[model samples]
Target: MGVIPFLLTYDIIIKFIEKSSIGINYLLIMSGGIILSLFLKGYLYFQGLNASHEAAFDTLMGMRIKFVEKMRKAPLGEINAKGVGSYKKNLIDDIDSVETLLAHMIPEGIPFVIVPILIYTMIFVTDWRLGLLSLGSIPFGFIPMMFMMKNGTKKMPMYYKSAEDMNNTIIEYINGMEVIKIFGRTTDSYKRYKDSVEGYRDFTLDWFRESWTYMAMYTAVLPCTILLLLPVELNVYLNGTLELSKFIFSLMLSMSAGVPLTRMLDFAPTVIQLTYKIDQLEKTFEGVQLKEGNESIAIKKHTIEFKNVTFAYEEEDVIKDVSFKLRQNTLTAIVGESGSGKSTLAKLLVHFWDIQKGEITLDGKNINKFSVTDLMNEISYVSQDNFLFNTSIMENIKIGNPKATEEEIKEAAKLAQCHDFIVEMEEGYNTIVGDSGDKLSGGQKQRITIARAILKNSPIIIMDEATAFTDPENEDKIQAALSKLIVGKTVLVIAHRLSTIVDADNIIVMDNGELIAQGTHKELLEKNHKYKTLWESHMKSMDWGIQVEEEEYA
Candidate 1:
């Protein structure tokens, strides 16, 4: 279908002397060729574009969802290693690079490679002289750019890292702009951001300049190919080495070879960068992802056991050979100074970090087998650094249970001691929180997070200093509400404030990542160790004149 029309048009057009005095037979064949070629090429072009678009869209969306799911399921140790700035860079800039490759660069380059081989092959059969010259031009056009493209690929990772640094600097500057102004420290740090922007600009423009300069030379090189073949073509014509029709076909073929060849060089940097970006995204996606299914966490029973569990972050052990157990429905408190691994212990029970050499079990089954999605369905966590999305107050509370009824949300808010203040707002439940709930005070934000947990009403509750920022009245109210919330669930409390968990059924004291003491509040005081010192400090900080007397062991 293609060959007959190409030859017919080539011969017919070459023979037609004047556009004014059109050859009827030649005109019909030429019109048919134009129509047929246009339709075929247009169809192929649209098909290729659509395929690339679909593929790029899937990879882009998949990377986003995969990274989010990985973060939710990965060990906190692994997840935290990838900081906010790096992850942000991957999501925004890195993904954009991949999209360019998938969409424009790759799809377009396919034609660059395919059409050249084909057009050159046809010219070779007609006249070998023009064919050899055309083949030689391919290497000349591509070889010089090969080293630069290789270097560009090597530079890509650092370029992305540098770009991310600029991104982070800008984000940091904006986030700290108010503080910088208040402290009058803007000049020093903001200048650094200005420099980073310039650096990125210079790097980018240099890359473009190098690519375009070489590319223009490569394109300009193609016309010289015609001149190189000129002598050979003339000799062939004079000695009956090439016929008039063959000469015409060779001319068209040489002209056609130039385009896809120059394009391959012009597109080289994009292709290289795209390949690199996709590889990076794949690395990001290769981590674990949380899944929802029947086989989630182990079934809850009347008791929970921690059998000599040990855990580490990188090389440093955060929790060491820790062993403890709690009867069902009891509040187990882990109390320690900051950095003593209290929070790490809380995370272990929730299966955030699987034990290295020990076992955590409910009903004598290892918890690691269960999916995080399943475990989260039964566990509610309120950390000291509570995070809330920018949304209506009602919706933030509803995060605990997306389908929670309005009444249920309000009741949860009431239980968390936030209902009164929420009602005072002009929009009440409809009030919109700014990013990370920044519009609210620490106490209010904590209460909102608490309300979210309450709305969840999971069977296992983990409170990691949940009241660290609540005011006195709100603290008392939240404590009272938490008392009710913990009634039937297994509760784990991680606190730096000893008083908060003074009434806990069990208090395990940690120091230097080791469990140094364990017992009820009364028992730990007589032990006269870290727990006693912590308790005494808590009492003194309150300015209490005397310690409350307890029943004597004597």
Candidate 2:
């Protein structure tokens, strides 16, 4: 309607110039209506965008919450296998991409597409021939889009894979920067990081170079609805089959149709990105299906029995036909050479990965029959890689028992031999540990984790080389802490240092994933050949140290 009045205003001006029209009322009214329409259009567009953003953010919040919940329920082994970089990307970057789909594509693209169809229909109703001519170029436009889709389909998977690889490399580079610097491996460390970045760059460039031709073709053809229609309309008017006013209106309407079509075409890449991201999110959700127990069993005792347990990580068995029993209120130490499955045994008892052949029983009941929550509550696990959060020292220790009082936290810290260091700090327990406890020394961090375990005070405590990083001076303190924490509790300790577990109630020797012998340290030293050799080696290594002498300098 506005187009007709505006076009007619042009004709009316010509008539007034010829002295065939005297008043300018029609021109003034048409100008006012166009101005009013422009204001209304701006208002509606902003309103729509605002509403879409609100919906998009709400949807994003829900998705993030569900994703976190899914991760919590998933097995730790499954999560580790997927890698932290992949998980972070899906949780943060992939979910952010969905916001683009909901906020812009669904709300704005709909109007951009639907309004054009309606506008073209109006043009066609006014003159059927012009309408047909206007849409004649769309088939050619689709030819380019089809090629783009084909090329995009082939490259998108590779694109996302390269991106994930780069993300992983970046995380590793940052986290291991200190190690790289200390080992003088700056070149090698940066090489891997550089390779991943270059790989992603090359992939992106190759994809764009291959698809640019098809993209240009579509861009050129999709928004030119008047290209073929204009000449045909002019020919019809010359033949006296169409009036000038109808011809002008048809031309304007064709241009309007092209505007929306062009806007709709711009959304094609967003659609592809959204579809691929959705697939990635679904894959993440499907990756970890944790096998949960039906009920939480009542555990009366802390004895653990592994009955002919056979287990594998990647088709190769790490623990083969392993049978062992740990009695309640006893300390059992597992000592073995490297790659001898010492840590694996401790992990199995904690149900980190289920065994392939037999069940592990706790208090004569299959551990699998107990709920994961109950199982975790019954055991306290401390490993060599003791992770500490970036928070106050007091808060980090309190994570073991969230309901623990401040006094209890201090007591646990004191028992772990970390109270002296904690109090020496400027803020004492309130000092932030920085990222992953980087602000603290290795021994300090280890002691804090021990404090956490002490605070947990579970009936069963499994220690996998928990004191491996501590200096000889702090070893005594840590041992004292362990003695207090494990009183009357079933303890399974994986030890690399033979001297630390020499007095263990029962020392189990492992070789090649098989338990070779089980006895006290003295009995093993006399009866087991492997145990004697390992002990000799450990003693020699402990005694070996560098000495600086003035005689040598002279």
Candidate 3:
């Protein structure tokens, strides 16, 4: 399309110079050729762009799915350590940035690069001297581009780090808004959020400031092919060494080459930024993952055993040489101070992370031998931090067993002591839970999660402070439901309220990272000093609460 115009112009100039009358048929043919070339160019460009966008969207979906699968396989501790903001950036922002590379650069940039070379080839064939002169401004343009790329590469890490920091700060600020307001720390928290945003803004501006001069220089110089070609080509034509027609053709071809060359250079910054984004994604895709197996073996019993298991999040061991057996159809309770690794034990049982030493087995088979899905299918874990998706109450409960009927869901909710309250709501079972079940109270959310667990009816149930938020009146109801739920199942309960687990078949007492004692609650109270002390303290706190109530009544 570009060459056709230059060829037609050469023909017209020659005809005019010769003082010959141009025929109507010749003019019509040239006009038709120009129109045909333009239509073809536009049609091809549209098709290429359409194909590229489809490919780009497909690639985006595949990448996001792969990322989610990787997250599922990776250790939960590692995922949490990366923070919600980092994952948000990687999953949404960073991955979305690849669209430009796939949808624009690959399809359009290739043609832009190729067409310029072809245009230059035509000019060189016309007159080699003129072609050489046409490339004179290229070296100057390239000098600035090289500097820009080098500077961008050097600053890319810092820029990405600031962006991640800002994302994290913003998310943290929003999530902690309740705590901030409650504690009257809103001003301080806002300052930190403000500082993070300002830091990102300042760093971005500084980076742009450093590159703007080079950007201006290259963008101005790269397309000005006439800078050298016009003067030198004219002199050569005057000297009669170059034909007038060839001189004009060469000049037109050189000018045409500039459009494609400039278009190619326009993606240079995106290419650099894309490299950094891909590297960030690769770090996660290539990170260490929990080992899993493909076997699906039948278990005669749901007995879980941890044999001298030692594990660490980073360096310091959190669970040290801990060995315990949870027999089938028994309620086992783990009791400890805040950092005594009680919650960690429950997490390990579900294979949230592989232990560094020893083995965790289900019915004498190592847990790792079962596929992740199979392993998860056998256990129902309910933690103090109950998380529900932003969906209808029915859907949230249905997650435990997607095949469950509406009647089964309501039954489970009744067993969880949540049915009455749920049905009282305007939307009944279909009530939207809002974000993370924020529309419900802490106790209500906990009951909903319990309902989910009950609906699952897995062979093994692990409840870590599951009843921590329930009021005294509802606590008894939930305990009764829990008794029914745990019947004929393996249960592990982590309790801060010592009275709740007094009837547990076996109670494991932990201090620091080691299992200090394990026995029935009665045996532990008599034989273990730690257990006796914890019980005494719990009793004293209960009495203190009663005494305060009595005084208020007086």
Of the pair 2 and 3, which is ahead by TM-score? 3
Q: How accurate locally, in lDDT, is each candidate?
A: 0.79, 0.85, 0.91
Question: What digit string (tens of lDDT, one per residue) describes model 1 on residues 1-554?
Answer: 22334565676667663334666876786878868877876787788789999999898898778667666776776766766677887787777667777786656777777777788788887767678865656566666577678668777777887787788788888888879999999889889889999998998888767767666756677535465565677787899867776777776666655656666666777777777877877787786543223474447474678888888877788888888987778999998888999888777777777667788876676666666677677789999989989899999999999999999999999999999999999999999999989999998999999999999999888899999998887798899999999998889998877888889999998888888889999999998488888988888888856668888796
- The C-alpha stretches of model 1 lying farther than 4 A from their native spots are 1-9, 17-22, 39-44, 105-107, 205-212, 223-225, 287-294, 544-554
User: What TM-score should be assigned to candidate 2?
Assistant: 0.89
- RMSD to the hidden true structure, all candidates: 6.2, 3.5, 2.1
Candidate 1 clashes between residue pairs 3 or more apart in a chain or in different chains:
296-370
Tens digit of per-residue lDDT, candidate 2, span 404-440:
9999999999888899999999999999999999999
Candidate that would win on TM-score: 3
User: Each model's TM-score, in the order given?
Assistant: 0.89, 0.89, 0.96
Worst 10 residues of 2 by lDDT: 1-10
Q: In every candidate, how many clashes are there?
A: 1, 0, 0
Worst 10 residues of 3 by lDDT: 545-554
Clashes of 3: 0
